[model samples]
Target: MGGSDSRCLRCGSTKSREVRIFDDPQSLSEAVAASNMPKEIADELEKRISSYNLRLQKPHSAESHSSQHVAAMMDATGDDGQLTLSSLSRSLERMDIHGTTAEKLIGQAEFEGRLIREGQDTWSWLQQSS
Candidate 1:
Protein backbone atom coordinates (compact mmCIF):
# COMPACT_ATOMS: atom_id res chain seq x y z
CA MET A 1 0.00 0.00 0.00
CA GLY A 2 1.03 3.61 -0.58
CA GLY A 3 1.27 6.31 2.06
CA SER A 4 -0.46 9.68 1.93
CA ASP A 5 1.73 12.70 2.39
CA SER A 6 1.14 15.80 4.52
CA ARG A 7 0.32 17.99 1.52
CA CYS A 8 -3.05 18.22 -0.15
CA LEU A 9 -3.22 15.73 -3.04
CA ARG A 10 -5.02 18.32 -5.17
CA CYS A 11 -3.56 21.66 -4.07
CA GLY A 12 0.04 22.33 -3.10
CA SER A 13 -0.73 24.33 0.04
CA THR A 14 0.18 22.90 3.44
CA LYS A 15 -2.62 20.97 5.12
CA SER A 16 -3.79 21.39 8.68
CA ARG A 17 -3.10 17.82 9.75
CA GLU A 18 -5.40 16.14 12.34
CA VAL A 19 -5.53 12.34 11.99
CA ARG A 20 -3.55 9.63 13.80
CA ILE A 21 -3.17 5.83 13.49
CA PHE A 22 -3.53 3.22 16.22
CA ASP A 23 -3.40 -0.53 15.45
CA ASP A 24 -2.43 -2.55 18.47
CA PRO A 25 -4.53 -5.69 18.92
CA GLN A 26 -5.34 -5.12 22.56
CA SER A 27 -6.18 -1.46 22.04
CA LEU A 28 -8.23 -2.31 18.96
CA SER A 29 -10.23 -4.85 20.93
CA GLU A 30 -10.83 -2.38 23.73
CA ALA A 31 -12.00 0.38 21.39
CA VAL A 32 -14.26 -2.02 19.57
CA ALA A 33 -15.86 -2.98 22.83
CA ALA A 34 -16.45 0.64 23.70
CA SER A 35 -17.90 2.29 20.60
CA ASN A 36 -20.95 1.77 18.34
CA MET A 37 -18.74 0.88 15.39
CA PRO A 38 -20.81 -0.94 12.77
CA LYS A 39 -20.88 -4.69 12.15
CA GLU A 40 -18.46 -4.74 9.21
CA ILE A 41 -15.73 -3.53 11.53
CA ALA A 42 -16.24 -6.42 13.90
CA ASP A 43 -16.16 -8.78 10.94
CA GLU A 44 -13.00 -7.15 9.58
CA LEU A 45 -11.26 -7.78 12.89
CA GLU A 46 -11.46 -11.50 12.19
CA LYS A 47 -8.62 -11.03 9.76
CA ARG A 48 -6.47 -9.70 12.58
CA ILE A 49 -7.11 -12.88 14.50
CA SER A 50 -5.02 -14.73 11.95
CA SER A 51 -2.64 -11.93 10.96
CA TYR A 52 -0.31 -10.14 13.36
CA ASN A 53 0.67 -7.20 11.15
CA LEU A 54 -2.71 -5.82 10.20
CA ARG A 55 -2.19 -2.13 10.61
CA LEU A 56 -5.32 -0.31 11.77
CA GLN A 57 -6.21 2.82 9.88
CA LYS A 58 -8.07 5.97 10.92
CA PRO A 59 -9.87 5.56 14.22
CA HIS A 60 -12.62 8.19 14.17
CA SER A 61 -14.47 9.07 10.94
CA ALA A 62 -16.12 12.16 9.53
CA GLU A 63 -19.59 11.32 10.80
CA SER A 64 -18.19 11.13 14.28
CA HIS A 65 -16.38 14.42 13.75
CA SER A 66 -17.50 18.00 14.35
CA SER A 67 -15.08 20.62 13.20
CA GLN A 68 -13.89 23.27 15.62
CA HIS A 69 -12.97 25.27 12.56
CA VAL A 70 -16.44 25.04 11.10
CA ALA A 71 -18.03 25.46 14.46
CA ALA A 72 -16.15 28.66 14.98
CA MET A 73 -16.78 29.84 11.43
CA MET A 74 -20.47 29.17 11.78
CA ASP A 75 -20.87 30.60 15.24
CA ALA A 76 -22.44 33.66 13.70
CA THR A 77 -24.83 31.63 11.56
CA GLY A 78 -26.55 30.24 14.63
CA ASP A 79 -29.17 27.62 13.78
CA ASP A 80 -29.44 28.18 10.02
CA GLY A 81 -25.91 28.10 8.64
CA GLN A 82 -24.78 25.65 5.99
CA LEU A 83 -21.68 23.51 5.73
CA THR A 84 -21.18 21.73 2.45
CA LEU A 85 -20.38 18.01 2.34
CA SER A 86 -17.45 18.35 -0.04
CA SER A 87 -15.70 20.82 2.24
CA LEU A 88 -16.50 18.63 5.20
CA SER A 89 -15.15 15.69 3.22
CA ARG A 90 -12.01 17.67 2.59
CA SER A 91 -11.86 18.50 6.28
CA LEU A 92 -12.30 14.85 7.11
CA GLU A 93 -9.49 14.01 4.73
CA ARG A 94 -7.33 16.58 6.44
CA MET A 95 -8.30 15.00 9.75
CA ASP A 96 -7.27 11.62 8.34
CA ILE A 97 -10.79 10.25 8.72
CA HIS A 98 -10.94 7.46 6.13
CA GLY A 99 -12.38 4.07 5.21
CA THR A 100 -15.61 2.86 6.84
CA THR A 101 -15.49 5.49 9.52
CA ALA A 102 -15.32 8.17 6.85
CA GLU A 103 -18.41 6.76 5.19
CA LYS A 104 -20.28 6.67 8.47
CA LEU A 105 -19.13 10.16 9.24
CA ILE A 106 -20.44 11.42 5.92
CA GLY A 107 -23.74 9.68 6.55
CA GLN A 108 -24.11 11.04 10.07
CA ALA A 109 -23.04 14.52 9.13
CA GLU A 110 -25.60 14.60 6.37
CA PHE A 111 -28.22 13.23 8.71
CA GLU A 112 -27.53 16.14 11.05
CA GLY A 113 -27.53 18.73 8.26
CA ARG A 114 -24.04 19.91 9.11
CA LEU A 115 -23.06 20.02 5.48
CA ILE A 116 -24.56 20.58 2.03
CA ARG A 117 -22.87 20.02 -1.34
CA GLU A 118 -23.58 22.50 -4.14
CA GLY A 119 -21.12 21.96 -7.02
CA GLN A 120 -17.53 21.11 -7.77
CA ASP A 121 -15.15 23.39 -5.89
CA THR A 122 -18.06 25.08 -4.18
CA TRP A 123 -19.38 25.22 -0.62
CA SER A 124 -21.01 27.89 1.55
CA TRP A 125 -21.28 27.12 5.27
CA LEU A 126 -21.29 24.30 7.79
CA GLN A 127 -24.22 24.12 10.20
CA GLN A 128 -23.60 22.68 13.61
CA SER A 129 -26.65 21.63 15.58
CA SER A 130 -27.61 24.52 17.80
Candidate 2:
Protein backbone atom coordinates (compact mmCIF):
# COMPACT_ATOMS: atom_id res chain seq x y z
CA MET A 1 0.00 0.00 0.00
CA GLY A 2 3.02 2.35 -0.57
CA GLY A 3 1.75 3.63 -3.90
CA SER A 4 -0.62 6.64 -4.31
CA ASP A 5 -3.50 4.19 -4.95
CA SER A 6 -3.24 2.90 -1.37
CA ARG A 7 -6.50 3.51 0.50
CA CYS A 8 -8.90 1.76 2.88
CA LEU A 9 -10.53 -0.86 0.63
CA ARG A 10 -13.62 -1.18 2.88
CA CYS A 11 -14.04 2.59 3.22
CA GLY A 12 -14.15 3.01 -0.61
CA SER A 13 -12.84 5.99 -2.65
CA THR A 14 -15.65 8.45 -2.09
CA LYS A 15 -13.61 10.37 0.51
CA SER A 16 -10.43 12.18 -0.40
CA ARG A 17 -7.16 10.22 -0.27
CA GLU A 18 -6.04 12.34 2.74
CA VAL A 19 -8.72 11.44 5.30
CA ARG A 20 -8.14 8.86 8.04
CA ILE A 21 -10.37 6.91 10.43
CA PHE A 22 -10.20 8.31 13.96
CA ASP A 23 -10.71 6.34 17.20
CA ASP A 24 -13.02 8.94 18.77
CA PRO A 25 -16.62 8.50 17.66
CA GLN A 26 -17.13 12.26 17.07
CA SER A 27 -13.99 12.56 14.94
CA LEU A 28 -14.83 9.29 13.19
CA SER A 29 -18.31 10.58 12.42
CA GLU A 30 -16.89 13.81 10.96
CA ALA A 31 -14.50 11.81 8.77
CA VAL A 32 -17.25 9.42 7.69
CA ALA A 33 -19.49 12.34 6.68
CA ALA A 34 -16.71 13.87 4.56
CA SER A 35 -15.66 10.48 3.12
CA ASN A 36 -17.22 8.65 0.18
CA MET A 37 -17.85 5.72 2.55
CA PRO A 38 -21.39 4.57 3.40
CA LYS A 39 -23.40 6.54 5.97
CA GLU A 40 -23.57 3.61 8.39
CA ILE A 41 -20.61 4.68 10.57
CA ALA A 42 -22.98 5.31 13.49
CA ASP A 43 -26.26 7.00 14.45
CA GLU A 44 -24.26 9.58 16.47
CA LEU A 45 -22.69 10.98 13.27
CA GLU A 46 -25.99 12.77 12.59
CA LYS A 47 -25.77 14.71 15.86
CA ARG A 48 -22.09 15.44 15.28
CA ILE A 49 -22.78 16.51 11.71
CA SER A 50 -25.52 18.86 12.87
CA SER A 51 -23.20 20.37 15.48
CA TYR A 52 -20.46 20.76 12.87
CA ASN A 53 -22.88 22.32 10.41
CA LEU A 54 -24.12 24.77 13.05
CA ARG A 55 -20.56 25.81 13.84
CA LEU A 56 -19.87 26.32 10.13
CA GLN A 57 -22.99 28.47 9.78
CA LYS A 58 -21.92 31.02 12.40
CA PRO A 59 -20.36 34.38 11.44
CA HIS A 60 -16.57 34.55 11.23
CA SER A 61 -14.48 37.72 11.31
CA ALA A 62 -10.97 38.70 10.27
CA GLU A 63 -11.35 42.24 11.59
CA SER A 64 -9.45 43.83 14.44
CA HIS A 65 -10.01 41.83 17.64
CA SER A 66 -7.82 44.40 19.42
CA SER A 67 -10.59 46.97 18.91
CA GLN A 68 -12.81 44.82 21.08
CA HIS A 69 -10.05 44.68 23.67
CA VAL A 70 -9.77 48.46 23.60
CA ALA A 71 -13.54 48.82 23.76
CA ALA A 72 -13.72 46.51 26.75
CA MET A 73 -11.01 48.49 28.50
CA MET A 74 -12.69 51.77 27.63
CA ASP A 75 -16.01 50.51 29.00
CA ALA A 76 -14.29 49.70 32.27
CA THR A 77 -12.86 53.22 32.52
CA GLY A 78 -14.12 55.57 35.22
CA ASP A 79 -15.88 58.97 34.78
CA ASP A 80 -12.63 60.81 35.49
CA GLY A 81 -11.00 59.78 32.19
CA GLN A 82 -8.31 57.71 33.88
CA LEU A 83 -7.15 54.24 32.71
CA THR A 84 -4.63 52.40 34.80
CA LEU A 85 -2.47 49.52 33.62
CA SER A 86 -3.90 47.26 36.31
CA SER A 87 -7.42 48.22 35.30
CA LEU A 88 -6.65 47.54 31.65
CA SER A 89 -5.05 44.25 32.67
CA ARG A 90 -8.24 43.27 34.49
CA SER A 91 -10.27 44.29 31.43
CA LEU A 92 -8.11 42.10 29.23
CA GLU A 93 -8.63 39.22 31.65
CA ARG A 94 -12.40 39.72 31.49
CA MET A 95 -12.17 39.81 27.69
CA ASP A 96 -10.22 36.50 27.72
CA ILE A 97 -7.17 38.12 26.10
CA HIS A 98 -3.69 36.82 26.85
CA GLY A 99 -1.18 39.12 28.55
CA THR A 100 1.35 39.53 25.75
CA THR A 101 -1.33 40.07 23.14
CA ALA A 102 -3.12 42.50 25.45
CA GLU A 103 0.09 44.44 25.97
CA LYS A 104 0.74 44.56 22.24
CA LEU A 105 -2.82 45.74 21.67
CA ILE A 106 -2.41 48.44 24.31
CA GLY A 107 0.80 49.55 22.62
CA GLN A 108 -0.94 49.59 19.27
CA ALA A 109 -3.85 51.60 20.72
CA GLU A 110 -1.42 54.17 22.10
CA PHE A 111 0.49 54.30 18.81
CA GLU A 112 -2.72 54.78 16.84
CA GLY A 113 -3.87 57.58 19.25
CA ARG A 114 -6.82 55.50 20.45
CA LEU A 115 -5.20 55.58 23.87
CA ILE A 116 -2.83 58.19 25.30
CA ARG A 117 -0.04 57.35 27.72
CA GLU A 118 -0.45 59.45 30.81
CA GLY A 119 2.31 58.06 33.02
CA GLN A 120 4.69 55.09 33.30
CA ASP A 121 1.87 52.68 34.17
CA THR A 122 -1.30 54.53 33.19
CA TRP A 123 -3.23 55.38 30.04
CA SER A 124 -6.30 57.37 29.03
CA TRP A 125 -8.90 56.54 26.40
CA LEU A 126 -9.24 59.33 23.84
CA GLN A 127 -13.02 59.13 23.94
CA GLN A 128 -14.67 60.15 20.70
CA SER A 129 -18.33 61.10 20.98
CA SER A 130 -20.00 60.13 17.74
Residue-level lDDT tens digits of model 1 in 9-123: 6897676666545678888677758466677877788667546443332224332334544343343232434444454556555655444343454455456675554555333
Each prediction's TM-score versus the true structure: 0.25, 0.45
Q: Candidate 1's error at 99, in angstroms? A: 2.3
Off by over 4 Å in 2: 1-60, 127-130
Candidate 1: clashing pairs of residues: 62-105, 63-105, 82-125, 82-126, 83-115, 83-125, 83-126, 84-116
Tell how far residue 123 is off in model 2, in angstroms.
1.3
Against the true structure, candidate 2 has what lDDT?
A: 0.70
Pick the lDDT winner.
2
Worst 10 residues of 2 by lDDT: 58-67
Report the C-alpha lDDT of model 2 over 32-121, residue by residue, as the tens digit: 666754557555677799999877765343245545776767866768887777777777788776535556766887888888888887
Instruction: Give the 10-residue window scoring lowest on summed lDDT in candidate 1.
Output: 54-63
